[model samples]
Target: MKTLTIRRPDDWHLHLRDGAVLEGVIADTSRHFARAIIMPNLVPPVVTAQDAVAYRDRILTALPQGDRFQPLMTLYLTEGTDPDDVAAAKESGLITAVKLYPAGATTNSHGGVRDIDKAMPVLERMAEIGLPLCVHGEVTTPEVDIFDREAVFIETVLDPLRNRLPELKVTMEHVTTKDGVDYIMGSSGNLAGTITTHHLIINRNAILVGGIRPHYYCLPVAKRENHRLALRAAAASGDKRFFLGTDSAPHVDPLKECGCGCAGIYTSPNTMSCLAHVFEEENALDKLEAFTSLNGPAWYGMAPNEETMTLVRQEQPVSYPSKRDTGAGAITVFDPMFPLHWQVVE
Candidate 1:
């Protein structure tokens, strides 16, 4: 097996929650990603330029000493989001993009946009400022089946948004279905998508094969086997439009195991190792560099990181954290679908 080394990768999307939980989990991410687009769905939400700056500072302070990880910030889009605030944050470089979460769609998303149509003013401002809108593309309608939420979202929300605001740039975060891949490939230039590590490695069966695995349950939850195959194809196609975004969200073990579990997958620790295994399996190891390193920066209109990291194909079993002591009792670490045989060579 050939050993591969390339520029350090950037996680285009991540959730490094604030306070003690943030302190406990930031290191695993810093060890792997040189930078990451920090999500803004905090309890109150990072809704303004000031909020973004303060959050960025907290992340910087939380980073392990001597580490050079940069946390790119984003604002949570809401109905009342000020256009000037969006433009100011982008201009000041305090925020890189704006995230639109359909209210009630995901964790701590109650403060998200209630009506997408009503939020066109904010979208228009984003387009004018050249700030990309990263979206949690599932609709929250009660009538939509859980499995079909993503596809339904594309038909109802994304398709209309694309047509209405043709100039607006958007990134569909953590896409898990064939429809998502096809839509992204079809839209090519104006729209792009971020495929997460867990989505690429597991399908719905992995969640229900033996029992209901809560760790495998995430927003825009894993799709059917055929969709999983489609996602793998897109990632290995050597396509620049598809790239890495770990959406490495963490929840204390109790929150995940409670009656109503939180929606997120903590994959920071094994992200790159998992991706290496997937690409190698597809015989697309040659294109892994572009997917992990080149594509994310290109999509964000930034330069690829100059530093390099290496990975070797070796069989090793890494332990999953049963509980992380994040000030609370413990937060559970998510397990990717299979045994990871490849590991990053520090």
Candidate 2:
């Protein structure tokens, strides 16, 4: 068995939902990551600098004792968002970026920007202050098929946005298609993207392979095997433009298993282990550290974490925890299908 050690990794994107669910899930993230860009799409949404501060405090309060995990916050971009508020949040150092979710694109994104045109002033303000705009890149037209949303969004939305605001830094969050991979690659140094664990490990077939595996279902849903191959190549390419972000969103079991299932995968507890499996299988284990630790901070203009962690290539069966206990109740956990073989050494 081989042993590898590298700088402590940060999850550039994650969802640590509020209160009980947060309490139950924070430890899983803290155990594996030193910091995470916390999504602000709560029930009411964190739209202002003040809201972001309060939300950050709630995330801190929810973490287990002695955990040094830092929750990097983001402001939810809405049609009526004030430019001054965006600047104020960035100046306060509480927010690292602004999240743009096309209205109706994903979970709790109904408050997201309905028309990107309406938010030009906000995006401009962010560009001025060096705040990157993290986008949930998917078109929500009723006529567009689910799997085609990402590619369509790039052509119809992102490309136009880039042409319009050439100075603005954009991160195409959880990119799932070959077109997405090409867009980021074609953009070179300016625009970047975050790849998720589930997207790298599973394809759309995982959803129906064994009779509708609800846990494998996620928004910006997984695509065909060829797309998965493209993602694998990009992540393993050691390209600084690509980096790690678990998008470890947790939903209650009942909500996920219901008729209209929720969209997210809860992999915070096992993200690193899973990535190690994928990278190792690709024979790119040597480049894992750059993708998992270095690329993200470089893209964000922050330094890599000073601390280090180790993982050993040992075969081990990891049980899937169906639910994480919190003050309220157990919040359901997503199943990553197979047992993980790598173990992180603290």
Q: Clash totals for all models, in order?
A: 0, 0
Q: What is the lDDT of residue 151 in candidate 2?
A: 93
For candidate 1, lDDT tens digit of each residue in 168-268? Answer: 99999998899999999898367999999889888888777887778888888888989999999999998889999889899887788877888888888
- TM-scores across all candidates? 0.97, 0.97
Q: Per-residue lDDT for 1-346 in model 2, tens only?
A: 4798989999999998888888878899988788899999999999999999999888888788898898999999999999998898788788999999999999999999877889999988887888999999999999999999999999999999999888899998999999999999988456999999999999988999869988888999999999999999999999999999889998877778889998998888778888988898899988899999999999888899999989987756655566787775656665666777778877
Each model's lDDT:
0.88, 0.89
Model 1 bad stretches (over 4 Å): 315-323
- Give the clash total for candidate 1: 0
Query: How far off is residue 68 in model 1, in Å?
Result: 0.5
Give the range where candidate 1 is weakest over 10 consecutive residues by summed lDDT: 315-324
